[model samples]
Target: MSTRIEVVAGRRRWTVEQKLAILRDAFGPEGSVGDACKRHAIGSGSIYTWRRQAMSGELGGARPAPLPSFAEVELSAPVPGLPTAGSHIEIELPSGVKLTVDSGVDADALARVVAVLTR
Candidate 1:
């Protein structure tokens, strides 16, 4: 004689938004797909499918594209009050002109612009 076990299925179906939310939380800085699967009792394959859909633009509400490289940005004059190449406490432009620039400005581009301005 053998005994049989019955399984009860979940009543709710997850929507796209819900799946995205779960995926985002699951893949956040402190989270991982494996951890999420283990915690939520889900399959690893499902997480991968969601990731593929997200990457292929099938999912909405995704993060925007990254900034273009320095090589891609057009070179321009430095803004007033922007830091230029120099030693501590001194704004040293190749031409000795002080200018202000936004933080995270490409140093290489700045150097090239300074050289042109000095010449």
Candidate 2:
């Protein structure tokens, strides 16, 4: 006999949208019932119940907006004396901190600085 194990987070209540998402993932492409159960920390029983409910029209389901799997990015070698002072990037943090950096700023270094600030 397998005992169901659940991974609980800070929030216990799951919204209808979340439940539908779990159901979709449980049976969508790359569907593996056991793997889905383990990944979501939910039980196979619950998945089946949701499936039945959906099929019987007991549950109202909506097709979520499809998300793009990947985006095209262009990377080019940096040019000298480029990205003049006038070209800048600005980001506002939740705590009202305004961060401004030049376009030529190193992405990895800027990411590290942002990570430290967010923490």
Candidate 3:
């Protein structure tokens, strides 16, 4: 008696649509790169390659939009007698983008400003 062994050859090909869908899910809330890779049975390297292809317009897929990032703001009790109105927070992004928000600015309005600036 002999045991039979079969070998599979060739890499799995992913469609453009499938790549886009997986990327979208990965960027969605509660989604992560590791989780997406495990769920899709794909490799992290493949995901990066797909992302590069998408960015370079070689994938014929929609380019991933830059997601808005928000930072938590905590207003510590004004130092001694510092006027709150004159107090503003300055945020410097990794891209060297700077944002200054007044202490009394509306939260919603500030978020909108940040969303636009980051994009």
lDDT of 3 by residue, 35-118 (tens): 999999999888888777876566885564565655766666647654378588787854588988786778778778766655
Candidate 2 clashes between residue pairs 3 or more apart in a chain or in different chains: none
Cα-based lDDT at residue 106, candidate 2:
77
Summarize candidate 1's per-residue lDDT along 4-110 as a digit string, tens digits: 99988975466788777778768887878878888766787877887777764555655634332344554498767744555233346533587766655567887
The lDDT for every candidate, in the order shown, is 0.66, 0.71, 0.76
Best by TM-score: 3
Q: Judged by TM-score relative to the true structure, which candidate is superior, 1 or 2?
A: 1
CA lDDT of 8 in candidate 1?
Answer: 80
Clashing pairs in 3: none
Per-residue lDDT over 10-63 for candidate 2, one digit per residue giving the tens place of the 0 to 100 score: 955656677778888888887778988898888898889878777545566554
RMSD of each: 12.1, 15.3, 11.9
- Ordered from best to worst lDDT, the candidate numbers read 3, 2, 1
Q: What is the lDDT of residue 14 in candidate 2?
A: 58
Please, what is the TM-score per model?
A: 0.41, 0.39, 0.44
